[model samples]
Structures are given as structure tokens and as C-alpha cells.
Target chain A: MSTVRVENIKKTYEKGQVLALDDVSFEVKSGELFGLIGPDGAGKTSLFRILTTLLVPDAGRAEVAGLDVVKDLWKIRQIVGYMPGKFSLYQDLSIEENLNFFATVFNTTVAKNYHLIEEIYVQIEPFKHRLAGKLSGGMKQKLALCCALIHEPKVLFLDEPTTGVDPVSRKEFWDMLDRLKARGITIVVSTPYMDEASRCDRIALIQKGKILELDTLEQIIARHAQNLYAVDADNRYNLMNDLRKNTEIVSAFAFGEEQHVTLPPHFQDEYLSAFLKEKGHTGIKVRKIAPTIEDTFIKLMLENQ
Target chain B: MRNLVFLLQKEFRQIFRNPTILRMILIMPIMQLIVIPLAADYEIKHISISVVDQDHSTYSSKLVNKMTASGYFQLVEYTQSYAQATKTVGDGKTDLILTIPAHFERDLIKFNKAQLHLAADAVNGVRAGLGTAYAAQMIGDFNREIREEWMLLPKFNEMPQIEITSANWYNPHFDYHLFMVPGILAILVTMVGAFLTALNIVAEKEVGTIEQINVTPLKKHEFILGKLIPFWVLGMVSITLGMIVTFVIFRFLPVGSFFTIYAFSAVYMFGVLGIGLLISTFADTQQQATLFAFFCMMVFILLGGLYTPIESMPEWAQWLTRINPPAYFIKIIRAVYIKGSAFSDLIPEFLVMIAFAVGFNALAVFNYRKRSA
Candidate 1:
């Protein structure tokens, strides 16, 4: 059975004025690391809340660990761990106390769950006496993960776990998740960072409370509809303006250090180069490159919009 | 049930760890117990007075001296004219004007009766009313003394006299603190339980720990009990501390059993903490929760009949106070501590508290959705 299952999960907040989730459905198999890649307010948190049994779907059903979310929420709560998008650790407690509290609340002891949390706990163990509020952001993230994982949950849901951490810590957090996945723990995490999407076994791209696509990392990139080209000229601003006026160009947007342009069907790169040159541009380079997840997301967002 | 103990442990640890909240838990009731009752004293004192003696007779001067000597009034002026005495009262220099008319001593010899006029500044009606009553009591004693001197005559057989003496039991002296301290104690306990319980939960909500707890397998009652039990214990401790202060300063202890006070306090706390938990569940932020607690506390105190008697309230409000948990508690504490009232006499109050405890806590747990679904 899949570790987590959601079917046509629809959620509307504020008496149907705001649709936080719209017929969202996906499944995560046991021992697979899945990623929900979207910007903020793309229903990622809502979807996670449903799977963890913290919220109910308006018109759908979901099951975690073979138990229905609504009918068996208590049973699901025992096996599913949720780290909300925000830092939810008790700030007044020390690092050791927070971990101990969570472990005991789960009807277990830190000694019983020590092996599961040892890898994450060691990083914060030296400052175990320090208050959770006094820890650095990376340390707080590590502490929250330790509290969530102390129960040895079958499925782990982490929402935007690395939003404010430094790049190094973000990389370390992903490595930690990778290590947990290697231990046969099913992990479903959400993030707006496109680069993190490649770290998951499968990824779902969501926007405006709807999933645009769901596939493996390689398959998502392989499914990009538009052929992308990097256009570099003497000036990026003037190049973007010139490229927008190009009849051969489909759409152009700045992509950091260069302008990425999509060409029309049955169009060649030389035609774009010739068009740019004719528009008072010189020393321009156009290179066809493989699409990153960011490029694919932008393409899908444009298509959806 | 197994998880409740662990949750309670965590709650106590968190409460004691924070210095500001810890101070509020440990010291606030003690401070208020010492200060609030002292400020709440209702004994009337220091009423300024002036005498207008037009008779220039011994009886008139004797009456003037008698009014000042009673210790409830201060003779600020001794005037010869009623107009001057009225001026003193109008100038806000005195509270009462005693007018002894001419032929005051001769009228008693001719017609066997005398008349005197006394004018009081009635701006503060309670003070004026109490001062006039005290003055009238002293003047009646003076009239009885003169009558006793006259009744010594041969044919005066003291016509059908009845003297009644009253004993104000439990608080014989009627010191306001004796009556006020227990009421304040009840209020302090109520406040500590309700305000802290609500604030503690909303603080958790503010820090986002509530979301973490909500996602756990903990039941709603477990979470609420864990939140409430600590404040309930602290509230009980505040009552104990307040009673200790009450005994130390006022030299009064509950004439009834201590068990009755603690028992009633525990039930009262259940009702109050449940209301507080309900507020925390309804409010999304600590500020909102604090304001809700404050507003409810106003209703609880005003309708609880803490400073005023419930019998004095409007008929509609008295009906509301029947359901107000604090009102039932304050009456119970006063009757038990002062009157040494037994449980049999408080059965109605106890049953009402039982209903409130069950009703409010059940409603709180019902409104408190662990699923947020």
C-alpha cells in the first residue's frame, strides 16, 4: 500500500471565499522521497495538513499508512509526523527538554528513540542545555526534525523546512532527509526552491491551488513543452526589450545574468540571432540548454496563467 | 489518561521556566491580597463639622461638644449665626452644620420638647447618609441620658421601655477587612486561574507550539487538562497564600474547615479555567485572548457581587448572577469563612458549581477541535 494517499482533495477556507486546495490528488509510496514544488500559497501546506490528519478535505478522502485520515486520525497521528511550515518548537524549553517532551508524549522515551534521532541530535547535543529560542535557525530546524522523528513515524511530512536557513544548512538539511529516506522512511516535503525538486524521487508542481504536473525529476524536465535558449548581449535590459519585439521569439523573461527566450514553432536559433543582430545588437550568443526545474515551472506557470 | 501526566509535566516545566510568568504565578496574589483589601475598606471617617449655637446656653454647648467628641466628626468651626455655619458648609470646609436654635434649654422646661436642625452636605450620598446616622445615634443616646435623669422623679414609672442589644457575630467589630479579605481572596484565585490559563494557551498558540501539539495523538481533554491543571494548582496556591496573608494581617482564619474552602476553590477553578480555555480556543492571538479574559473578568466581578451584595442588584442581574460561577464561589467562601456555614447549607451552591464545571469544561473541550477539520 502507498504510505500516503490523497484523492481529489478540495479545501475552501473563509466560507468558500478562498479556495486553498482544488481537487488535489497525489500518492507517495513507502520509502520514497517526494517533493511538492511550488511558490508560497500554492496549497502545499493545505495538502500536507490533510495527509497528517490536522485538517479535513472539503470533498475528498485521504489515507495515511492504510488508515483513513478522518475516520482514523488518532491512529494516523501515531505513525505520521508533521513539521509545519513555521517553527513550532516550544521556545521556552531547552533543546533536550523539547526532544524529551515530544518523545514522552508519543508514549516512548528518548532512550527508546535514540538511534533514530542520534544522527540529527548529535549536531545539537553539545548545546542541549541551551534554550530552543536561543539556538540559531539551522539548529532550531534540526531540533524540530529531531522532535518530529523521535517517534520513528512511518511517514514524515516536512513543509518548507529550509526557507530561512543558510545555503549550507539547507544543503545539510536535504542530506539529512536523504539519509532518512535511505532508512526506508517515506518522506513528503514541500518547498518553493526548484533545485530541491531534483533531490526527490518524484515531484509535483502546483500553482493556484492546482497541480500543474506530477512526475519523476527526469520525466518532469523531459516533459518541458518549450525549447529554451539563453540570449546574451551587450546589455541585458536592452536585449530583453529587443527580444520582446522579435517576431520569431515566443516569450522572453530575465533569468539572471542572461535573458531566456522561447522561440515560436518551426523556428531556428540562427533566425533569432539574425533578428537580434538586425535590431542593433552585436556580439550576441544563443545557446540551446537543457531545462532546469525552474525553467519548466516558469513554462508551466505561463501555460496555466 | 497515560499521556495526561506527561503533558502536565511539560506544562509545569514551561510555567516555571519563564521568569516573568513565574513571578506572576508566585507573587501577584500575595501582593494583591496584602494591598487590595486595605484599599477596599469602607469605614467612613473624618467628616468635618461646624456648630451654630444661637442659644448661648449650657445644653447647646453640651450638644455641640457631644457631636465632636463622638470621634466620627471634626469640629472645624464654632459659629454664632446659622448663615455663617451655612457658609462654612458651602465653602466645602465642613460636612455638616449643627443649628442649635434660641430658647433651646427653656423649651424643654416649658413644652417638654426641643427642636434642632442639622444640615449635611449630601454631594457624596453614602458618606452623608452614614455621617447623619452616626450623629443621630449619638443624639438619641443624649436624649436617653436626659430622660434617665428625669425618670428618677416620683411619678415617672419609665413607661413600657424595651432595650435591645445586638451582637454582630463572626465579625463583631465589623472591620471591613474581615469581610473584604475573603472576597478578595476568591477574586484573586479566580483571576489567576482564568487569566493565566487563557494566556498560557494563547502564548503557546503565539509561539506556534500549539500546532505541534495539535498534530500529536494527544486528545482534546488531555491537552486542556494539561493546560488547566497547572493554573488550577497555582490558583489554589494563590488562595492559600492569600489566606495566609489574611490571617497574618487581619488575624482572622476561616471559622469553617479548610477542606471546604479548598474543595470549593478546586471546583470553582474548573469552571473558570474551562471558560478561559474556551476563550483561548476562540481567540487566535495572545492579545485577543487577553482582551477576552479582561472583558469576561469585568462581567464576573460586576455580577459576582464582590463589593456589593447580590440582593442589592437589579432583579434581572440577580438572575444572571445565579449562573455566574464566581458569584456562587464568592458567596460560598464568605458564608463558610465568616458564618462557618456547613456543607448542608451550601448544597445549592455546590450543585450549581458542579453543573458549571461539567458544562463549561464539556463545552470547552467540544469547541476545542484537535482536528481543526
Candidate 2:
């Protein structure tokens, strides 16, 4: 079953001068952990806001749990839990008070939904009496999630939930989402972190307010059609320059430890290594490697350009 | 309704928990109630005066003695020259100067009347006017005393038989506390209603917590209503507590029904909270909200007739006061308490307050924006 369906959605700011979301359309399957992968200003927040019924699209329709977003906003609010990109819990209220207040807003008790947020809540339960402002960043994120989940929303929209959190907390948060997904909650999460794309069941690579590609992680990775290699030499800058000058090389860009290069299908490694040695590139190393999500994202972006 | 109650509870808890804010809200009203009345009196007493006796005659000396004997003036200096006496008045060392000419008792006996030059500083018009009246009364009493002692009868041309008897209504004793305590309570209530709500909402926006609520299933109206109801109730609670203190310590109680006072105050509080919420919508930070709220409260209190009577204000000012919710509320509270007027008598003011409450609340909700999804 489709939990969320967005069609032909477009959002523009400053009276349509700046397009934040351009003809955005996608669907999230029920019980699936979906990811909207993009960098900052890529309309991730704009798209999330539309689907969550906090915003109205200029043209198009979106439905959460088969209800139109615009017509049934009240119903949509009851069914969907949204954790915004920023930590927005009440700072003056204690942790427990914040949780209770949100729960009361939804006409439910914390005790009723205590089981839903127990895993995340326990981490901060020791400091439950402390003001939400006084908590660490990680604790604040957990409290926000707890408040968002108090009503047992079927669809959770997390807009960059792990943006500023430490690596360990980020991992723990994704793990919590996985557990929530197991309980049949569909999660639509947006993040700029490329590494987190692999953790989602399906991912959409979006940039400049448009989706470049949308598919399962494995499928998106499998879509890379170039012969990719990592090349390292004593002079890395000269190596990149030398590779870029060769018309035979389709694309050559630096990765973390070495430079990743894409060559024509007919190019042979023996000939390339020999060609590098003859060009006074000593101690050169060339090895075939798998393309990462970021590599594929960059290649797709370049291909579109 | 349930949500509103929950929010109100949360707001009360938050306010009581923060000692600094709690003290600011409570201590200010109490101080205003206790100290402002004493500091804001119009009645004059114990004015310092300097006497310059150029003649040093029996009549001049007697006039000086008569002026000092009256409790209104305290004779602080006896100057020989007019320049020194003028300098004393100019330097604020004395409030007035009495210049007695060089005339013997023979002038008063022969001429049947003597002229005394009284110089008064008119820097403060009201005080100077009152001082002149007091001086005339004192001199007239002195002349009458002399005539009675000598048993000399003077024929009068005409005396008006029309008598004017004035009776001060409401507060007959003119107790400033009776008038001020209610006005102070109104200011405190307005402060809490306007300032606290604005600061609370703007603080959430500044700290990014508003984004958290924005993404939730909470409707914009629900969120705004949730925030306002608590502060409105709190403002009413503060007003009630202030009234209690007014009755207990100051021994001033309203003659009308407590229910009527609270009803109008409750409606007025909604208007104030709505204004606060409106200010919060426009401000991005707590500091901006605080300044905005302060500015609005200053206008509201000044025009609300807290300091001056609305009836005495100019026509344009009176029209402006018509829209001032506090002005109407203060009038209602004072009338109901002092005049024992019924609810029907305050129908117009009540209607205006209701209009403010609805108009401001609608503006607040309209200005409140949701996230651009």
C-alpha cells in the first residue's frame, strides 16, 4: 500500500521567483524506510513540508494515507508524526513536561504511547526533570522524537533529523528508525549525508529542487554504467591533470584517499598503467573499485550537466 | 477545551518554576501598589518660604508671623534685601517670598487697609496657583482677626445669598490608594498578558522549537490557541491576586460584584494576549518581542486612564482612549467598585472590550504562519 503519494508538486518562494521544489513527485510505500537524499537548498525541507501538510503546493496533489493533503489537513496531522530538521522542543519545560504537553495536545497520555518511545526515552529518562534547554544535543533530538511519536503517528516525516548530531548518535537514531519501520510505520526522512542513503530501503537523489534518480539503494548503485578505477601516484595533482588531458578518460575526480577515474569501455588497464609510467609518473598505482553512492550521485549530476 | 486546559497548566508550571520571571511579574505590581500612590499626590503642604522685611514695622512683622503660623508655609529664611530673597527663590531654596513694605501700624489704622507684596515662584503652575490662594486666605484671616479684636464694624455693599456646597462622590475622602490600586492591578495584568506571551512565543521561534511543533499534527489554530489560553488565564489569576492584596492590605474593595470585575478582566486579557501573540508573529527574537510588547504596553497604559482621568482628557485623546481596552476596563472596575454600578451600566465598555478581544485574536491567528511545506 502506498502511504504517501505526491504528484506534480511545485513550491516557489518570493511569489514564484525562487523555485524551492520543482515539479516534485514521488511515493512512499507502506512500512518502507524511504530517504530523500540531497544537499542543503535542494528542496528536501520544502518537499517534506508539503507532504506533512504544513505547506500548500502551488500545483499538484499529495495524499497521506489516501487523504488529500490540502482537503484533509486535520486528519493528516493526526496520522503523521513530523520531527523537523531543527530541535524545537520547549526549552523552559522539563523533559517530562515537554513530553506530557505534546501528548496532551494530541489528546493522548504519555503512558498510552510510552511503549512507542520507550527505547529512545530511556536514554534521557535519567535527566527527565532537567529543562529541555539544558540537555545535550543528542538528548534534545531524542526528546523531540518522543514528542513527535506521542500520538503514534503512522507516517513519520523526519527532515534532516541527524544533521548536527555526533556520529554515534546519528547511527543510534537511524537504528531507532529501523525499529520503528519494523512496526509498520512508513518513514520519509531527508538528509544531506550520503552515507545514510545506504541505510534506507529506497532513496531519491535530489539536487537543485529536482530528483536526479529514485530507486532502491542497490538498484541506484547498480545503475552506474562506467568502468571506474582509483588511481594514486607520487604527484596526485599531476596525476589528475595527466588523466584529465587524456581524451580516452571519460571522467577523473578525486575521492578520499585516491582519485576515481572513469574510462571508455575499450580502454585497457595494462596500456593505461604503461602510459602513466612513460609520462614520468613513478610508483603509480591503479586498481578497479566499486562506485559509492556519492560517486554515483556525482556521476549522475555530471552526466545531467 | 481539553488542550487549552493542558496548555494553561503547563504555562502556570513554567511561570511558577522560573523564580526570576515570577519575581519580576509579582514584585513589580506589589511595589507599584504600595509605593506609587504615596509618590503621586496633588495636594500641597509644608511649602518653604523666605520673608524680606524691608520696613521691620509692627504690621510687617505681624504679617510674617501670620504666614509662618499657618501650617501651609514654613518660614525658612529672613532676608534683608530683595535681591537675596529673589536669589533664594530662583535657587529653589524657597518656594515663595513675602516682601513687606516699610509701613508702620499707623498706615493700617489710618488707611483702613495695607498692601502686602507676595512673590511666588510659578515654575510649577499648579503649585504656584495653590500657593497664591493660600497666601490670600492667610492675609485675609489676619485682617479679620485685627478687626474683631478692635470691635470695628465695616459696612459691606452687597453679599450674595447663593450658596455652593460641593460633595465629592465615590471616594469622598479622596484616598489615592482607592483609585490607584485598581489601576496598578490593570497595568500588572496587561504586562503579564502582553509581554509574557509575546516573549514566550518569540523565545520558541528563536530557539527553533517552533519548528518542532510546526512539523507535528498540531494545527496552526490549535497551536496558537494552546499558547494564548494559558497566558490569558495567568493574567486573570494575577489580577485576582492583586485585587485580593488590595482588599487585605490597602482595605480597598470594589462595591460591585467580583464576578463582574473578573468577567471584564478576562475579556480584556484575551485582547492583551492576542496583541502579544500578534507581536510574537512579527518578531524573530525574544528581545524584539520584549521591546515591541513594552512599547505597546506603554501606549495602552498611558491611554488607559491609569494616571489621568479619561473625562478630563482632550477630545482627540478621549477618542483614542475609546479603543484602549485598559481604559475601558479601568473605568468599569472603578465604577463597579466605587459606584456599585451594575453590568447593564457597563454594556458599552464591555462591548468594546469584546470587540478588541475578537479583533486582536483574529489578527494574531491570521498573522501566524505555518512552515512552507
For TM-score, the strongest prediction is 1
TM-score of each: 0.88, 0.80
| Per-prediction share of native contacts kept | 0.94, 0.82
lDDT of 1 by residue, A118-216 (tens): 998999999999999999999999999999999999999999999999999999999999999999999999999999998899999999899999999
Per model, state how many residue pairs clash: 0, 4
Compute the lDDT of residue B293 as modeled in candidate 2: 75
Chain A only: list TM-scores of all candidates: 0.98, 0.96
RMSD of 1: 3.7
lDDT of 1 at B78: 87
Deviating ranges (above 4 Å) for candidate 1:
A233-238, A241-248, A270-286, B48-69, B73-125, B128-165
Off by over 4 Å in 2: A92-131, A221-288, A299-305, B1-16, B44-167, B201-229, B255-260, B280-284, B342-347, B362-373
| Top-lDDT structure, candidate number | 1
